[model samples]
Target: MFSKSKCFVGGQIWSQTTRRITKWLKEVKSSTIRETQLQPTCSSPVYCYGPLLHTVQTAEPKLFKDSKTFVDMRMIHSQSETLDTFNKLMEKTEGKPSHEELKQFVNKNFESGNELENATLSDWKENPKFLEKIKDPVLRQFASDLNQIWPGLARQIRPHVIENPTQYSIEPVPNKFVVPGGRFMEPYYWDSYWIISGLLICEMPDTARGVIENFLWFVEKYGFVPNGGRVYYAERSQPPLLASMVDLYIKYTNDTKWLKDNIDTLEKELKYWLNVHTVDVNGNTLLRYYAPSAGPRPESYREDLETAKGNQALYTELKSGAESGWDFSSRWFADTDGSLNSIQVTNIVPVDLNAFYCGAVEHISNFYSILGNDKKSAEWKNIRDEFRESIYKVLWSEEDGIWFDVNITTGEKRKQFYPSNVSPLWTKCIGQNQNMVEVGDRVAKYVSQSDMFYYPGGIPTSSNRAGEQWDFPNAWPPLQGIMVEGLANSESQMAQQLSFNLTERWVRSNLRGFRDTNEMFEKYDCEVPGRYGGGGEYVVQSGFGWTNGVILEMLNAHGDELTADED
Candidate 1:
């Protein structure tokens, strides 16, 4: 009876091995892992009993573990010899394979198996080896989904694809630039700034620099950094931050000459946004910037106005108010502008854009001073001050306790409470007394209240249960970081509390998910704790760069200031 049982188990192992090897060989091309002429001896039961029984006995877990230890020890002894062989091959190949060759090699070597197909939950629990192999595959699929929905998330969150020097040569894809969320993100200029902050936290200064240089290169090659570099990316220009990035790069590398060379390109980008994109309305001459009529679609509330044609009309109308330097025509569209013609209407002034322009001017002035252009420095300072004064005079709402976007055509405030109203405080462009206190109070109120802007993760980009929820329950890392830094600058007690709250929430969220399943998700659903917010409508990403970067920076700043002393 014992002999019969051993033969039964042996037959099972042999059949499994034969099926696995056949399937693997069939899938691979003839060029790789050629099949040997040797065949299994199924005809002779005696031969099967001899080797197969011995194989099953030796493959027992206890014996296999000991065998593996011996094999590993042997490998350690031959490590030097193996390394030498590898080095010789590398030497013979003259360093690295070409891009095409590397791609072919990867294609040949990488194989996806059917281990995950129709895999049941119980299967994962029972099969440790199968579960282990599918872990990375599952993550990769999630990442693919993230990249498709939120392209920016991919760029900001995905792990850096590293090329081994010996195996592959890295090359840029033609007519391509790194998109924020994913592989083919619709390029946006300001978005990269936040993305860079995350990169900095990863101690990836080189990658951070490459991302910055890509923007600078775009500015040099195209005269202006279009909302993004691609044709589809021409919707709106974001706040100019090339000078700030240059400053940041200098901070990391102390490469003054690099700053010097890029200074000209930076200056041009500044001028393009400040002079060309902005307009002077009613003799105020305050700095005004334009947002492409195309706003973020997935984030916006109204589905009807999210179309390209609708946004185009909005853009055309906005251009007409180019003279006012303050356009608010687009603000009311989602609220009350019922006509499709209303989509073309522009003249709406955006508070965040103006505030960002203030920051750009301040950075440019600082850059000029660094370059010893004192005269230009003074000029920029004067311009900055004038812009600041106009912002206070025209945009401030004493009753609302916040700044607002004004209608350039109508010359009235939009009366909508949004986060952009408080964003200017981060720029330090507002006054110290009443305006600061009021803005601080508003920010504190929004952050502390759970049903409003506050969420489990962090302060939402816009407020929930408000007129518009742009700042509601969704927390973006860049915005959250800026707000934390801004509040700290103002010395608001709320800043510390909010920072701690956000940091703890993020850390806990990551730990819970990773500890439970050994996986990291993209974004926590701010409205619903413990659930993943469906990624932006592009791709599901992993290692979300900005999220990881911001979390690190925020945690680092938990008991300290968010910005350097220079601010």
Candidate 2:
């Protein structure tokens, strides 16, 4: 059974409005879990309901300080006093949403992946020209199809009316947006990075801007983008790549005004990181994936409530790991169990999280320098300098010869290899970061391996072939783009070669899959060709937004020169 949340009863009153309140609950007996794929609903207020996390904007939003529970449709302060409320409110409200209503959502008959394939909030429309006369037929056809897919994926909502600027909520974003496909009906935080890439290539710049502006609306209220564009996702964020997203957006449109206007919001996002996500670890202000509270994630309540039982504290960590977007990877697990039950995610200080922070801070520092904030630029640059050094000193595992997520409790390294190791190179902080040029050399070892990291389709989520979606055999677009671009940026020739190889293989697989299935997928099985990827929380999904985006990018970079026209 799929994980479904919110067992809610109707008619709850809040802020002088007769509203429907949702709650996430857990009632587990024996070790078995049962859930429904749910009958399809024609319309929802937000893209999704978690199976229960969907959101509709509130007219008069109330600011909440509890970061433990729901903060959707609210404002959160970036500073400590306001930040304090978020931390506290979150503690009280998490998993308080009704879980009883879930059965009502279940279909009288079972639902399948094919049933949910077209379940987006928006209808597919044609806005841009589809390529017809491209040299490589395979590349041309896939690009044309992804361009067609964007319209069906797009959504538009009204601006949030939050009572204050300090509150954060995951209400439906205030502008037009596109979801990441399949059950992901909301605009996700990190997925926007790749989606924007496809939007630019598709000549749909306006839609891309709408997506960014929608996120800016969130930054305006909550100080950072929520993990997804739903009010419920405000608890934990995805990868910190907004700076990179802005860079990509500007690269295509050169929107200076948007950057200038949002510079302050960008800085506030930095403060969100420094004030909330950062910790003074052994005198260094490094970042960590801190879950909101020691409660079950509203979306994954029953599964979490059962695993790591008798240890709610550890449960919070596990939820935080899911927030990291490498949800259910071996790196976060404690035992040999390959399932989600083995997750102990909060225990580690992720190298990628800090590496992303390194890039974000540096990107902000440079952007401010361009905006003529000299003092501010130097101040942020100093922060980046300290952070870059800390990543090397604290995160780079000398014994493993690559970065590892360090266990916070024992000060021991995770000893597991993940795509997290290549993140520093993506930030271009590898050789230049504390002059650790050898760090690139050490990382290239595993990246260069064929039977391991160098799969024919792309780098599998990681070298470990566990059943998790983020694990090996299943490779997603975000990691492919991240690893390839990071490699291209590296001074090492090996890094550049690997970048070309990664892009070529992934793009090739996308072409073959499009030819076979007439569909683009959320991920691909690296070990198989023209087949759907498997072993995630859900079935192999189609109409995937990021996969379409990154595939366009890879082909654009290497299609004519490197592609051999397998057709």
TM-score of each: 0.57, 0.74
Q: Residues 1-567, candidate 1, lDDT per residue (tens digit)?
A: 001111122112211121211221122111111113212211211111132222222332322222212111111113234345434544655745444443333234322221111111111111212122222343323223222222233233111212211111111112223344333233356656655654443344565666777777677655666554432223335566666666666766776677777777777776565434444444454444443332222111122233334344343444323212112223335343343235322354567667777777777788778778887687667657766766776687776656777766567777664545666777777743445555676666654653544565555544332222222344455555666666665556665566455555654454444445443444445665444444222233444544544554554444232221112
Model 2 misses residue 91 by how many Å? 29
Off by over 4 Å in 2: 1-135, 158-170, 308-311, 335-342, 398-400, 431-439, 564-567
Candidate 2, position 157, lDDT? 42
Question: Given candidate 2, what's the lDDT at residue 336?
Answer: 32
TM-score of 2: 0.74
State the weakest 10-residue window (summed lDDT) of model 1. Answer: 114-123
Per-structure clash totals for the candidates:
45, 42
What would the C-alpha RMSD of candidate 1 be, to one decimal place? 25.5
